[model samples]
Target: MTSLTASESATLERAADAPMLAQVEQWAAVNSGTGNLAGLRTVAGLLADAFAALPGEVRLVAPDSVENVDAAGHVKTIQRGDHLHLRVRPEAPVQLLLTGHMDTVFAADHPFQSLRWLEDGVLNGPGTADMKAGISVILAALGALEASPFAARVGYDVMINSDEETGSHASAALIAELAQGKTAALTYEPALPDGTLAGARPGSGNFSILIHGRSAHAGRNPEEGRNALIAAADLALRLNALKSAELKVNPAKIDGGGPNNVVPDQAILRVNMRPSTPDAMAAAETALRDAVAAVSHEHDVHCHLHGNFNRPPKPLDPAATRLFELVRDCGAALGLPPIGWNATGGVCDGNNIAACGIPVVDTMGPRGGAIHSSDEFLIVDSLAERAQLSALTMMRIAERGTV
Candidate 1:
């Protein structure tokens, strides 16, 4: 029921709009958060059905059983996989791959598992804004293309993956596997409220530093105690100093400490760093190690650092710039407002695909705000518009052959 301006029609995939919205509402009702195997399977079944109805052959990649440790050190393997090679045409080589994550940040026990109409046109739900809506956009746009002559040449692979919210640990290999040799990829993630898509994203890494120090009673034997907390504070200050204009280093959380009266024997500092480039990431790594060494030696405390960068930066290469310009032209053709974007500090699956050398538009979903929060909601009417833009871009690529 979201009303749109007259110009909005040109930007929307009118053919598949209604059905896609229905499908999104349906999928959103099913809680397929990354950890929910049963829900993921159920949603995958529906995805299989939809893909089967598409123009080309449909193949469901069997769900993968993956074991991982939780924050509490509990062991469990999540069920995951993808709907693969979901589309192919007779015209040219496959030029694009469409990827989405069926899993959301919400869990099965989360209270926001169900969907509801928040206003005249706005719908509120756990996954609706973040991605179920984006999935619908992907399917509906592809469905529109399938009914057109563009279907003959614009071959595409649609991968609805599991476990994207958890850094794509279980499916990173699959993402890389499918990205190989593709000209471009479009990922289904919510767009900015003004409908700006993602451009460059920083390479992110997580770090944990454990500080060990001697323990002794404060009053009885103060000289014998090597307070680790002091060393950890020094380390935190050094880390905070690493936040330059090009990179960000955050000492987010701290754990493992002792009573006030007794000298603290242990302290653990958890920090995250986001570097603008791979070299910046390396420099940050060196700085981190140096900070630990300096603080440890200066305070006579033992320290350990662990963890690594899971996703590299998605810089704006020439190919990506061309792809972005092409998308802008497609949007203009659809009569939408000028499409522009800037680099973001956040990271997404697009980084993973780009690392595999695939040009991608990761934030291709409907314009929305407040993702991963209770306030999240999509611009209900923008759904079809964004889908149309994607469909048109693919068609242009088909007509012109690799822009």
Candidate 2:
């Protein structure tokens, strides 16, 4: 059903012929979790070598330093793995940004380490669907693009970051930098199990609230101490109550409480907030401040809040809508069923790209299901299917000059 010129068909056939399954199997074997520095470095090298075949200047960019609050209520610098970046034909008139993450939720020592054959054509493994396949798809599509006749007229930047699972704090700046002056962006986060794309994404904010109180002996001077643990627990409850129709709050963990005989002197509360829109994000922040003030006053303690909403809400504006339409048309041209999208609460690098005023279609990867769990898998055949879709979409964009 996909009608194309002689040159277009040849280029796309090459893309579909890539050894994507082999590539994904190899990449998924390595544990490149956000906290796995050594593994990440190895995967980054492999990706760099693979991307080098795409007519570009390939390099590994060091991640920006990020900070975090430890369970001891002390701020510490967090080290992250480097990202693989490739810029091709920057001087070309049409520029685009393509992004993917090399990190997964599984740690280096996580038990979900080996790939297993769940059934024919379904391989269960960590990062198989949640993204190793996505990275392979990017390479296949770009490789085809380089071989196409329209290659000289189009340019694109490819970024495979190493810290997406834990929120991509280290690579956020790099994502923004690459998004500037691009016609549109395509992020390789996996499509839904049924192959539907993810449209608008909720903004995510993480916070570490520290509670300081006077420590006093239990029985002897219990009344003299302002229990920090109590205050932290109360704050968590108050934060949860702030959730609305457009905002969801989750108080994930609380750290720092010891020696039952002594009143706790300090405690740290970690919470997550997701807002569906920019206005919702702002309102959530204001409500958070108010809740913190009330808790601090009631418990007679000093409260210090750190962190802000890093990933802003990605709503479908006019430009984003146009990009989605183009992708849908490309899918139609590829003989794929009707392409549609729905908003999801999960966040990814696409949120960061959308914040830069660029149109982005995230979830342009192979169809799969149950990511982040040992059951994660890639719908083996979709690898080539999605690559052809992406290749055709880029070809159209290059020919049309815009989304």
Candidate 3:
């Protein structure tokens, strides 16, 4: 592990605790749900102001158009709020990418909108753990790094999008573009409460199958009616049965059905699939296609499948493993307890960054738990601990020119 100089150590030590937590409270108060465009814009403005403390050019880049399939099988376009991009020292020899998201799983109407102390050191609120606190950690770390003498040795591009929770449809292109030519990346996703990081992640795909059939009155001409609901149920069952050790299939929801007296003409099946490797992802896709074809032929109904694996599985390649080791070393130097990592079923933007061929250590944020739930909480002390860890890691990488 590279050692920190006296000046660098002092700068890291000055990353105050009270101010960082205060910013967390300020940001968590606003509801920046993935679907809340207006609220996301408000949060974007707040983040832009806070991140302005760094030496860079910060701008709100407009989101790209994304498509979604509705219950009726029509493709609709969605417009998301702008993503925040900050470019600092792009001309430096070593360039790194830092990413985070401003959106949360909670909606504007969600009941978990306030922040309060659950205990002496635990703060509870929506987005507090899921990522508002993580963003604060990123900003605080950057602020401390800028105060150090080696700040000019490295340059980084920060991309904080508003559509991560819903799949980064709008900001995906931006992430790929910024990640190009960078040596490494750091993403501020909150760590598990135990400080265990997520290592390899499975690739996920959400599918919506729409079945179309002929409707008829049950009492008048029951035999002439083709049951779309029954076909949808059959498809769901087939998908559920496809689950195995490598691939996990979940039939999340079904929509469209009417009175018992009339045979329903339309039905929609929503399903989620997770594949642990590239080969598994390929096999899962082929299996899904075959299932859809069989169901269409057997039920005599037109079936349409929508959605693809947005985030590919992030494997622990040699480069990624080296990056994790660097983080572990930094953690040890900062007096943090031994850090560990494990593969998780959940997917995050790290998968996308890895897809760009950039080695990334994503969950370098504060310790927190119960994300995506009303009971989510952030450990108050981890704010400063994680900031020092990230800042020191960045400084080490900048000095060494590689991990």
Top-TM-score structure, candidate number: 2
Order the candidate numbers by lDDT, best to worst.
2, 3, 1
- Candidate 1 ranges with C-alpha deviation above 4 Å: 1-15, 55-92, 214-219, 222-226
What lDDT does each candidate get? 0.79, 0.93, 0.90
1-403 per-residue lDDT for model 2 (tens digits): 3477788889889999998999999999999999999999989988988887888799999999999999988899999999999999999999999999999999988999999998998889999998999999999999999899999999999999999998989999999999999999999999987789999999999999999998999889999999999999999999898888899999999997789899998999999999999999999999999989998899999999999999999999999999999888888877888899999999999999999999999999999999999889889989999999899989989999999
**TM match of model 3 to true structure:** 0.97
* Candidate no. 1 TM-score: 0.86
Cα TM-score of candidate 2: 0.98
Model 1 residue 94 lDDT? 53
Off by over 4 Å in 3: 16-18
Residue pairs clashing, model 3: none
lDDT of 1 by residue, 1-403 (tens): 1232343343344543547678888888899887787888888888888778776777767645555433332345666645344757534565688998888888888877767777866778888878988888888788777666656777777888877887776777778887887889899888888889889999887767778899999899978999888888888888999999878988987766667789988887778889999789889889899999999888899987766777888898999889889888778776788889888989878998998988888888888878898777877888877888777777777767796
Listed in order, each prediction's TM-score against the native is 0.86, 0.98, 0.97
**What does each candidate score in C-alpha RMSD?**
4.5, 1.2, 1.3
Sorted by TM-score (best first), the order is: 2, 3, 1
